[model samples]
Target: MKLNLILFFFCTLVTISWAQSPNLSKYNEEIKKIEDTVKYFEVEKINDQFYMLIGGGGNVGVFVSDKNVIMVDNKYEIIEEVLMSSLREITSNPIKYIINTHYHHDHSDGNRAFGKMGVPIISHENAKVRMQKVTQLYGGIYDFIDGFVQDKYPTEALPIITYNSKLTLSEDGEDIEMYNFGSGHTDGDSIIYFKNANIMHTGDAFVRYGYPYVDLNNGGSIKGIIEVLGSIASLANDQTVIMPGHGNLSTKQDVLDLKKSLMNLYQKTVLGLEKGLSYQEIADSIDETLAADPVMPGAELTKLNYIKSIELELNN
Candidate 1:
């Protein structure tokens, strides 16, 4: 009886271990694949909207006026100083409103930096809850407080002003409208549309390069991203300039193209699953049918991940 019990315990432990070991081979390959994609630290003027791109895929927005400025998103904590310097060169106005598009590190990590400057951060109500958890757990708040001697973005830094769907900010003479596109990139994904400039900043939900990352864990969805992009596409025109969360500034056509690619990939995978292909089989096989179009943006989510995302969209 004792020997049988011991054997059963060992087998159960092995099974549990096997279940927990995630294969990171695809992740490593993704990092390698996007390594050559140059990360820009420069600020560029996209139409009337002045924008900056940080390493990774965070798109930082600067709506400048003689009185003050409203920054849509800050890239990373490290890049805050540089981004600030760039903003200062263009406008001497103090940064008043910083709207975070989501809770992703690349986009919202700079929340603390701006908060340090006494700037008020604005975001979806949910983003604050998510960032607060991250700051407490992985961000080492105790160490940060003692060593850095700096408040690593206290709770106040987290969107003192929260909203449900839409919020508008008027700084200087510019009118910027922030809209929550319902679980596109993340649960808190925001798109800042500059009403005066006819430029829209699609935060991460509108990357021009590779596949979009629907962080399903954080309320992201392939279908949601597609829906958001489609809405933006409808609002855009040839004259409308798009500032994506990553990649070069785009036109209305760029949004249309990205939407088409994503929808096509999604439909293809739905059909594949109808034929009873498993998720793995569908993900690994999507590229076979996609055939050398514009690749997806994120390294974390690769071409194969596109197939998996489609599979998820179908299952949901």
Candidate 2:
């Protein structure tokens, strides 16, 4: 009995240690698939000076020049080295700047990797604050998930440079402007524009995915998204090439159409609420209010998920 007890205690200790460290073979095996996906990245050249790196976590914008390169939204840390390898295929210039559009992990997770290499990161001041301080995320759908919320970012990962409204960067004969139009996807959302290229990177504020996710827990709202979309759309034209946070390259008309759809969704949702319909009921009734083109492949639940999110925020 004594020997059995000792063996049990030893097993318990080993289990506890494994759980705490989480770097054993089992854990590594589970993450190997993710690493495999990150090992291979895809690049789409927007023009001679600009390229798009996809497959990290968010779509990365690459602006290459004779002198150096600038990146927008450096996906997750897992894909850092692979992303750089892909970038080298296009330009030999070093990455001098990394502009984070928001504080979301998928968009800015790699900031630390780039920062460590002396690449200066720029973002809206609110984004920097959200990274340094803890913000309570409120929502029922996400409350059940453990480890889904972040309290704070590491000191090295925080944005080194922050701006209030707008900041302009002129390098390699390119004029890049970063603008903050209040809160849309987050309190510190930034819409970056390459002035000469007529290309805009609309972070999570504008995604190709159906029904944008508003982080109400992070100062995001459907109403705010509507307003922000209008502001960004005004800056586009027939010649504009929109590089959204996710999805394919878009034109100015696509942004406008999305704005109209969101407007319809807002009006329809309010009407459903007035009628005392349940959240799911309201979501079911608003199918016609969403955008129809470029249907989100394999994302059947995206609209419903977004509607549920809106329902949760509206009632709260």
Candidate 3:
């Protein structure tokens, strides 16, 4: 009887440990898949010192300095070595800081690799908290039709530095400002602006991808996104270059265009609600021109998901 009791306690402890630890096997498999797609990756020079790495995951903004490099978003894990190689092609400075625009795996999964190298990771406090545990991602047009589970990140992969609304890092005579404009794509989205370079890296907050995705399950709302976009447009000037979370380099005009599109959608959604239209009815009523907007490639489903998000926001 005592032997059985001891075994039971031991098994219980093991179960608890397994629950606490990140799924290393799953993490490794994901890394392997990302590495296999390295051929799609390309690095584009934005200016004298800043470069944009595209393909694989979210766009990465690389700010090369005389002594060190500051990365706005560090794609995936295995992709870090590839990113480092790409940086070496540009400059020999070591990566000194990693700033996560948000806690999404595509944008910040490389945090584990960089964190392991003792590179300090900075993000919004909410992002740090979200990264520390398993997260559910919803509102995708396809793969996330139901929802997707993002496993918890290991301790070393988590952000070491966190801020509430704003934080500034002065490096190489530049004041890099990171600002969280409340909840939009996620509760912790950060829009980073490089003062000297006049370049802004608007994480998932602004994407070139057709139809914006609002992660309602993760404190995201279309209304919030519209508000955030307005703020970003106001902060940007005609000369400012924008490095979107998942697209080619953009300009302030592009930001305004996206903002205008979102605003139009918000107004339409509000009008539909006022008319007592169901979410499906509103989605179906979106005209071809609006649904076929270049930003929303997956027209029908994307419209549905977007309308659903707006409805959820309004009802709440």
Candidate 4:
């Protein structure tokens, strides 16, 4: 009986270890290969409000106010303690609200963590649906969708509040306007604007480096991203700071340059579409005339991926 009990205990430990390996591994690749040597949560001051960039599956925005703390996206469950503790380095105020840019795992996995703190979590109605699927597939512990699915099963981290079109939030004297950026990065991608701070947090909807990934399968569109970015150009200006889905913090001119690149790609693809070119023909053949503009280093892969996504979009 004693031997059986010991074996059971050992097995339980192994199971727990195996279950946790995935969550930790999620950031392993990101942390291991950062060429910029940029640690997560590089702190910066914008209009007196401190903003921290928490880069994981995507980048998260930590907006510190005088009275309350507002978070854009939760990093991951494994890092919830770390992310929160890091926040403590800046302010001890409890996280008042968290907005899910979309339903992707890297952004929403921390929902359970913040939920435990009793903070109200909100997202687009579509974002909630996507997260439910990620939760079921990963068993609620990890974010990788394939190959690790068997090892990283996790529970669904659902959102408490969901908005369809737009939601305006006023908390502790800060004005945050969450606007759906159409079907750019995702069907429910939202642009979180801090009115007082003159900061706009563009989720995966606006990644700074590489060719942007438009998850067309999940209602993303390359053309849509271009249109959305065009609109955001008006929403921002020379003094406005832009928080992207990934990469470093940037400015309105930086965001504008990004839009121009996508627009160039779209115009190329549209011309190909007019010619009735097949997806492969355009993806492999369309000229990247705008590739040199944004000039994000190590984004050669992204350019190809952008071309391929455009081709796929035309086919669809």
Ranking by lDDT: 3, 2, 4, 1
> Which candidate's lDDT is highest?
3
Window of ten residues with lowest summed lDDT in model 4 = 135-144
Q: Mind giving the per-residue lDDT tens digits that candidate 2 earns over 1-316?
A: 9999999999999999766642234323423545776676789998998888877467899998788899999877666788888988998998889999999777887886887777899999999988886554433323222124454677888888899999999987889999999878888999999999899999989987676767788788778899999999998888999999988888888888888888887777788878988766776787663442353422334555555666677777
Tens-digit lDDT track of model 4 for 1-316 = 9999999999999999877654445344543444234344555555456575554456778887777888988766666656766677778877778998887656766776777667888888887766655222321111122222212213435677888878999987878998886888778888888887788888877775556656666777778988888877788888888888887788878777878877776777677668887645655564553342243433444555566566667777
lDDT (C-alpha, whole model) for all candidates: 0.68, 0.79, 0.82, 0.69
Badly placed stretches (over 4 Å) of model 2 are: 1-33, 134-147, 287-305
lDDT at 125, model 2: 95
Q: Which is superior by lDDT, 1 or 4? A: 4
Give the alpha carbon lDDT tens digit for every residue of 1-316 in model 1: 9999999999999999887654444333433443444333566765443655445437777776666777877766665566667777667877778888877766776776777777888888877767665221211111211111112346656788888889888766677888887878778887888877888888888985566556665667778888999888877778887888877788888888888878876777787789888766666654533333143333323555667656655666
Candidate 4, 247: how far from true, in Å?
A: 1.5
Question: Each model's TM-score?
Answer: 0.74, 0.82, 0.88, 0.75
Please list the Cα RMSD from the true structure of every candidate, rounded to 1 decimal place.
9.6, 5.5, 3.0, 7.0
Q: Runs in model 1 with CA error above 4 Å?
A: 1-40, 47-49, 53-57, 135-153, 278-301
lDDT of 3: 0.82
Better of 3 and 4 by lDDT: 3
